[model samples]
Target: MKITYLGTSAAEGFPAIFCNCKFCNEARALGGKNIRTRSQSLINDDMLIDFPQDTYHHFLTSNIEGDRIKHLLITHSHSDHLYPEDLVLRYGAFAHNMRQERLNIVAGGNAYDMLSKTEQHGITLLKISPFETIQLGDYRVTALPARHAIGTGALIYVIEGEKNILYAHDTGFLFDEVLEFIAEKRFSFDLISLDCTNVDIPISDEGNHMGLPNIRRLVCRLNEIGAVSASTRIVINHFSHNAAPFYDSLVEAVRSDGFIVSYDTMTIEV
Candidate 1:
């Protein structure tokens, strides 16, 4: 499996538009890894996780062939995550012959509604529920409940192929139901991409996000449950500019604690 980190920032993006905070200023000046867009990922050029407003920019920056994506897995309906309007571009008069295949878009209830409402073409929307496994070509994906929102029902996706990956983010602590579900499956994860929006905090007051301490606890728990092996890779992403630490500082801190801090355009092969 090849996972490419398209954008790694939270909603506002690091170095938020027109803001002049110290961190943002430093990030803007430093460029490179310090710069971040909204969160999104691509797997082996076929599967995509989240479709942020920065999708176009990501494609341009990475030189990605957008047409190569066959399946799109959405975690929720947050604008930073799912930009349905972009799907419309793949339809009718706007889209050229370059993109002709119907893209399969899989998501939970609210996300499904958002995508279904779009007057678009070349898209097959699939509404999924927690614990339901769906097969996409050579991959198997299972959606797990995310303790983020009520109407939207965020998700943590388990993607299996030659290797298994757990995409867990835009969320806080794992729900007990999710834990029970994992216990029953007994599947080991080769990679875990997690939420670390509040890297400087002990706990996140918002139910939708995770902090450094909670992430550490989650990692310890995963290790205790034998969900992660010695070779398992853990990546922290979806950062908030309000998180205090700057990009380089954040990377150093997480790296010292043995976790990879994901940056924009970072790619990993499993």
Candidate 2:
């Protein structure tokens, strides 16, 4: 499977929309990979993960046909992840040359509520729960509880196919149950996407986000649980401008740790 990092920033983006902090200023001045939008990704042009407010930008920049996306897996209802209103474009008359098939939107209850408000036509909302594996098209999707946002019930997803991938973000540490669930399944991820919202901060499992040091610890735990191996392509994404070391510095700091820093429009094959 091929995964495209459509946007790789945290809530306010890398440089942030209105931030003037040292990190944000550096990102703005450096440009290129330092520049980033909200977090969102596309898989093989047919499946989507998180429909951020930057979906339009991603569509235009990546040159991906919005209508071609057959399935959407939402991690949470965080504004940076799900903007249900934009989905109205898929409705007839809003877009031309769209396929007649309904877009399968698989998400949790909160996301479903938000999507239910859209006036979009070609849409089918599928509610999912933690640890429940379901077939979507040819892939088996397993929803895992995230340590972030217990009230909203955020989730991390594992997509099973010829090449398996675990898309985990907007999360901090792995819940014990989640680790057990992954261990029980005995599945190893070919690619693992993790949230690095905290960047170089010292916080670990205490916060709702993870930093570079925390990431190392988490990856070690995942390895011990047999969820990842040395061959697994690990990528860290969803960075906040408030995080330390900016982009280039942070990349260099974590490079030796075997994690690829994600940038907008970056693509990886697993």
> Model 2 reaches what TM-score against the true structure?
0.96
Error of 1 at 220 (Å): 1.1
Question: Per-candidate TM vs. native?
Answer: 0.95, 0.96
Candidate 2 structure quality by residue, lDDT tens digits, 1-270: 899999998888878898788878878788888898998999887899999999999999999988778899999999899988887777657778876468899998677777777786878888898888889887899898888877887889999977999999889888888888888889899999998988876775867888888789889988999989999999999988887435577678877897998989999998
Supply the TM-score for candidate 1.
0.95
Q: Give lDDT per model, in order.
A: 0.86, 0.86
C-alpha lDDT (0 to 100) for residue 72 of candidate 1: 91
C-alpha lDDT of residue 266 in model 2: 94
lDDT of 2 at 1: 82
Q: Find the 10 residues in a row with the least total lDDT in model 1.
A: 91-100
What are the runs in model 1 whose C-alpha is more than 4 Å off?
204-206
Q: Once all C-alphas are superposed, what RMSD does model 2 give against the true structure? A: 1.3
Instruction: Give the alpha carbon lDDT tens digit for every residue of 1-270 in model 1.
Output: 889999999899989877789989888888888888999999998889999899999999989888778999999989889998888788557666755387888999788888878885778888899899999889999999887875577788999999999999788988777767776799799999989988876665446788888888888788777788789999999988888546678877877677888988999998
